[model samples]
Target: MRRGLKISLVTLTGAALTLSASACGGKKAETGGGGDDKKTLKVGLAFDIGGRGDQSFNDSAAAGLDRVKKDLNIQTEEISAKPDEPDADKESRLRLLATKGYNPIIGVGFAYTNSINKVAKAFPNTKFLVVDADQCKVEGTNVLGACFSEEQGSFLVGAAAALKSKTGTIGFIGGVNVPLIHKFQAGYEAGAKAAKPGIKVLPAKYLTEPPNFDGFKNPALGTEAAKGQLDKNADVIYHAAGGAGIGVINTVGAAKKLAIGVDSDQYNLPAVAPVKEQILTSMVKRVDLSVFDFVESVSKGTFQAGTKKYDLSNDGVGYATSGGKVDDIKAKLDQFKADIVSGKIKVPTK
Candidate 1:
């Protein structure tokens, strides 16, 4: 379900030879236009730390690029960010794509907020999209922010966890202690409390603090965090960690406990095949839809600059029931979703 008001696309000028970097790699799709057409509409994506193989956040964004390649038949370039890389590297990545004539370049995570702002200003004609960041909301800028109501989705999954918890105790694992991930923590706690007033939600465990984003990519950290929670008798655990959440799912599955995923549907991901049955549900954040819609807008000459919010009202975020584990509780979850959408329930973001 695409949602947005279409407007005319802005024309961009200039193009340069492609460049490569040691910290990041590029994957170019040859589906769209070729040659030196100034209006080729090439899409560029700068992925977060975990990149495409995480089967999580980055992969969700990749799904959108894949759709653009297939449906729009447009050329696209993808670049992955290295863990803990300096902010300067992000700017360089975006600039490289812009120089290579990739219009409507997308910075996939909040980490690229500053980089996108700086680079978008330099390439005034090139349109830019930054995901998960609201700071890119500068007036008259070429950058458009694609932000999500992650708390709304997390709240639904938290309620699911509480309803399914046999021990009346659930846990949450976050990749980093940043405010973005905090939204997941806050909503999860709130929903769990709302669903089961006496349910015990262990203190949210963070794999790492600020600056050490390895928590988003390190499976070992996720495994360790899940172990601690399970040792405390947590029968169900939900993680907002990126690639690391894979470890949490695997560990919880092996222990015969339930695990919840984030971003994409983990139960359907081949990467998590061994423990798919253990995944109760996932907070499905529609990064894929957002990315695809933005690129489609650019290609169709209807690109708009500013922030677009994806939330329950628009079906932008929700929980996945891929394993039939949450089927019995779907009605309750939908009711909660309705309440949230109707303003009867306010899920906290902090």
Candidate 2:
């Protein structure tokens, strides 16, 4: 249930900042220093287009940072921008953090690719962690990127969905149509196909580009999309649309059909609570794991600069157990999980 964040990349400008990775989840406490030291590992975040508290990607990443701040008693500064915000505004936020000496500023999605590239290059000495990065570089002082094997996770989710579906129809709703989101759709479709052979997996996106990830931030729109899918006779729907997915889940709530989640455990989020039992399950992408992993590395003085990818191979992403409603189908779901984890089965992307 780890490694679900996608890596977004950008320019060659390097900046100066420290990267602090947490060792565990949600607010670790502070420990006394051995020397006369007030070492503050200040970390900054550039949230995905949906911003924070969407019960998804941004939230998962924040969960990890929040853990580090609480448990390690380290100073933390967080800034969340709206999905509709301009690129320049996002860049300005990054710049402001840099000026304030936030080290190892992390950009949560590909949308911040250019902003991170420019920021990192401008402050060459600052280290950056771009989750779901695209081979981004800031010259010498930076380590690299980190990513997840979404395909593997998506496959497992698809398989599980298929195993539980009784209507032979399912749906996938994505925030945008980028390769990252597309991969989720592809894997889901493949899984459904695998389980039922002829199962119908409908794939849709809220945006085409530019505001791709923004699609997830609009609840009204998400609800409308889910309603449409349900009307098409799909009893189950999976959402990879940041905040938009919540909207989709809400629609499923009203319609009484089943829904699936992505990024984090929706069962833990208030927005999706009403439909908790109906949430079938989630395709968990452990953004929190990656964030805290980085923090732990930083705490141990083992922090490095560069890109790190987490996938099924590295337990970066996987499926959530049923919201407990699909007990009748757990056997198939468990088998799917085992096959994927043991490499005996592979979920296709293409």
Candidate 3:
């Protein structure tokens, strides 16, 4: 029934888009200027790490673009960043999009901070949105920074692991040893101990450090990390690693252990169909929401520059229960979510 409801909603959304387009002379048009000026809106996306098919972060962003194209009848261009690509390369990618008259080009990950910063200055009239990058540092610019509270969602999943662990030990695999990933680690550790005092949370491991972002794309590294943790008697494991997380899920499923997914509802992904049962839950970061919201704002000509944040109260971050594997713990997770939103519980980002 839930799946049917979701499909119905999507159908309605598409119908609304079609209706709107028909009202505008058979196709929706961008109207940035006043008085009878009609132009087609073109948006561009620069994906992070594993790109669109990784079934994770990049896929989430792609979902947003798909919605914008269908609902708003907008044109979009998407490009993927190379593994360990330099800032200059990223800048060039954004620049290419802007030169082609794509307004409001977006960068999908924090790694694009330098690139977006550089490119935004070059294209003053073009609006830019950088996901997961610090907006405070870019305070006086024509760019918008869209940030999320990943720690809050990670905490919920971490607590779930503690309640469900048979061995009373769990593990975490991070994509990089940066502060962003650390926010995930800190919240997981805190929530595990909060749920079950004295429970053993295994040490966290990072596949690589900054300037070497292969960790986000290397499944081999993720599999290796998960194996090490599983060998240490961890019954459940969670990963904030991007594309590499695919390997983690595969490894855990092959071993018949539980694994937590990140960024998206990974259990629903076709790439993980064979091991769907292994995903206990996922820390859904809502990148799709952020991307879609920005596109909507641009379309309405209310596009604002500066920072925008997504958090627990805004449905920005939370855990997924797609496989019904976490049904027994649903009530407990709900309480945690309310507590975080109501300020009774403060999930750490450090």
TM-score leader? 3
Q: Mind giving the per-residue lDDT tens digits that candidate 3 earns over 248-282?
A: 99899889999999999999776677888989999
Q: Candidate 2 — what's its lDDT?
A: 0.70
Q: Candidate 1 on 1-350: residue-level lDDT in tens?
A: 11111111121234332322112334543322222223446678888887878889988998898898877776667767777989998887788777767777899999888888888888888888888875425333577899899999999999999999999999999999998999999999999998999999999999999889989988899999999999999999999999888889999999999999999888877667888899999999999999998877765556677899999899889889787999999999999999999999999999
Per-residue lDDT for 190-292 in model 2, tens only? 7777778878786564443655445767677678888888988888888888777888887886788888889887865777777777788788998888877
Whichever of 1 and 2 has more TM-score, that candidate is 1
Best by lDDT: 1
Q: Model 3 RMSD to the real structure?
A: 6.7
What's the lDDT of the predicted structure labeled candidate 3?
A: 0.81
After superposition, which runs of candidate 1 have C-alpha atoms over 4 Å from their true positions?
Answer: 1-38, 134-140
**Stretches > 4 Å off in candidate 3:** 1-39, 135-137
Model 1 pairs whose backbones collide? 7-302, 9-301
Score each candidate by Cα lDDT: 0.83, 0.70, 0.81
TM-score per prediction, in order, is 0.88, 0.82, 0.89
Model 2 lDDT at residue 306: 64
Task: State the lDDT at 69 in candidate 3.
Answer: 83
After superposition of all CA atoms, the RMSD between model 2 and the true structure is 7.0
User: Total clashes, candidate 3?
Assistant: 0
Residue 240, candidate 2: C-alpha displacement in angstroms: 0.7
